[model samples]
Target: MFIEPDYKYMPTTTGISLPSPKGSRFVASCIALTCVLCFVLPSGYSYGSALLCLTCIPLLLWFRPALSLTREDLWILSALVFYVIAHFVIIQYHGSASRYFEEPSRFLLGIFVFLAVIGFKPSERSWWLGLAIGTILGGMVALWQLLQTDLPRAQGFMNAIQFGNLCLLMGCMCLAGLGWAHQQACPRRWVWLLILAAVMGLAASFFSGARGGWVALPFLLGLLYLCFRHRMQRRFLLIGLTLMTALVVTLYLIPQTGVQLRIEQMSSGLGGYMQGTHVDQSIGVRLEMWRAALAVASEKPWMGWGETGYVEPLVQLISDAASRTQVAELDHLHNDILDTLVKRGALGVIALLAVYLMPLIVFARVSLRASPEDYRLRAFSLCGLLLVTGVIMFGFTQAFLRHNSGVTLFAFFMVVLWGYVRLAEPKVHSE
Candidate 1:
């Protein structure tokens, strides 16, 4: 019989091939360089590192011209553009253009990193491995910090705020890895290591004593449970509950350590708030600052004083308080929402919402539609959850968007979300 050749049995010449070794190496090096710039750079080094990272954009475009117009890529680009515009507007009105430049530049550099992440089709396994390395590195630094005699000294690449936030985010990442490892059908020794890393990270977070970070923990855990709910078997759920119970017991039993100190501070701060006392301790000053910011916002409802206007406005408002009590240097409002309202008014608020909320919307949509078997989707969903939690919690305590650390984190989350959207796109072939 003149039967057709078995196509399934024959070797196919038309299959889609992965990137070549050289291309993979190039992409890996780019990612590594970006990570170093992010982790190793000093506080104000973002300005220089951002410019260096920007040079990679043309290089990436040259390698993959097809990446220019992807939806995820465009979202990030648009966000950066909006941020830059907002910065310019603040400068035009406030005449402190230089102050906003660093943040905008960091945002732009983050866009380049996001594009680079999309260019490399890293598997979910590979991403976890990369995060694993970062988590371990951060954890070791924190452990060493813990062992030191200096109680209040700032060590490592990040400050107390940055370190605390990084630890919290890294902890979430490690926990996600632990969840994935448990679900995998292979030897899962790495899960234990990840669990240890998470503990260390949490410890570091507490040691750093960033009060806002403590508020972010429950939100992060809740998001994790929600994202992995389907994959959670009955036994897994039972074990999780048991573990949680054990953790609570351990925490309650242990002496004041790590986050316990911050918790105590928060309790005292809440007491001060309820009593309506200006104690200048714990979070009392922050509440006072927020009230002052509100007053400033009321005075300049339309467009506020401008980017750096809060310093003078805040100082003016707190003058009586400073003189009567003993407070010094009321620099920032310490609340992102209030700061934006007082400084940039309604337009700034809109920009801030656009920058943060858009990613949440995109990632939520992707999470809902992603296939159950897809791992990258899972990672993105977890990352999206972390970002939302971080934004909400950190917003209450600090003007996270105004500082380089917060801006950097915001950009990192955007890049991860961009990676997800880019990976989800259907490939087209030219005839």
Candidate 2:
């Protein structure tokens, strides 16, 4: 099925040019806009991701440009390759192809997103504007839900954790956008718009009552401080201090917010947990799952129990009926790293670390550069850093990649930012 193109005698007489840059840009913008819209309407988000992938194939072939792979891309590819190999081993050992097919299929989907974004070559401004639009719309929907819903949380169109994490990532992106716009000396109105989006996105995350996003708040602020340290020292200091003060005040006054309660529960559970008592709490349940996961992991330290070997064995290992009941309900170990440890063993954990480490190293390299021409790329790199950190932090309490929103959002934005940065790099060109 794979035909080698004859570069020597490619049909120039046909006069068929590649897709117009304008058309490609339009499609890329639509993809960004739709992704944001899906934050508030996640039922269609998966389908939108699929459509983006489907569209990417013809676009890439028409362009027929050689894809450029950065060092980071190679690293990410290695991690993905390791992941696929582990799954393939599981399939061969277990004689069932379901596990092998499912996760690899998702990775393939991520590859499509990565390829499509790079192929379209969207402008930086267009991509930021699309994200801004999505953030504003998502904020409005969350606000409306806050006012109308009887439930304790305002999750918008998705579950609380997903909505909260989406808002958190968007807020960081908006901040980066504002900083970039400032550096570019863009219109004051556009900067103000980005500020509004950042504020609203943070507000939506707060209203969602998902503390996982809040776990990354300090890291987000730290990144902002680091990014602006040389450029706007005094200004950033004042803003940072004021924001920190306000955050402290908000936490103190809003006893109704679940954050404080969640922390308390975690603290209490930890204390009781260390004393050999199994406390029935959110943190307690995760501890139980983690212990069971480790036990199973020890049984097959090399390649692990695979996807199929998780639940029943863990349940049987739990001596307490109550703990077993709770453990049985879990689809994965709550922690992403731990899940990888349990599913794929030590090698899997190393690969998982590479997945996070490679991107971090890549972005940090660009972000730390002093070139003015690299400002936008640096800003985007910072955004990518914060997004990766937030997801990793969230994964502590939940296996984020196991679900639809987590995988789709992470994969889409991961490539979108990486692709754009590579495209903008003067030394590297897609063609």
Per TM-score, the best of the predicted structures is: 2
Q: Can you write out model 1's per-residue Cα lDDT over 1-431, one digit (the tens) per residue?
A: 01111011212255523334444444444433333334334653244335436655775655552344656547657877797787677667777758567776667677666665555443444445455555556656655665664655223466677677766676676776665566555636767766766675666666667778777878887888888788768788678668755764564455543555557778987797679764476477776667767887888886777766556656567644643143235445667878778878887777777777777777776677767776545665667657766776777786766666677656755675566446644341111
Q: What TM-score number comes out for model 1? A: 0.82
Per-candidate TM equals 0.82, 0.86
List candidate 2 stretches off by more than 4 Å.
1-18, 70-72, 96-100, 183-185, 255-257, 275-278, 370-373, 429-431
Candidate 1 Cα deviation (angstroms), residue 256: 6.2
In candidate 2, what are the lDDT values of residues 1-431, reduced to their tens digit?
11121112122344644445654555565456555566666554565567666777777777654466777777666666666676666557656656446655566566666766655566566667767777877778777776676767767777787787788778778887665787554658778777777777787777776667777777887887778677666975797578756865685367654456656766787887777576556666778778877888888887777776777888887776777787787778778888877777777677667667777778788777737555667778888888788788888877787777787677667767877777666676423
Tell me the whole-model lDDT of each prediction, alpha carbons only.
Answer: 0.61, 0.69
Candidate 1 deviant stretches above 4 angstroms: 1-20, 30-52, 68-73, 120-126, 153-155, 178-187, 244-258, 319-328, 424-431
What's the true lDDT of residue 398 in model 2? 73
Where does the lowest 10-residue lDDT sum fall in candidate 1? 1-10
Local lDDT at 430 for model 2: 26
Measured with C-alpha atoms, the lDDT of residue 189 in candidate 1 is: 72
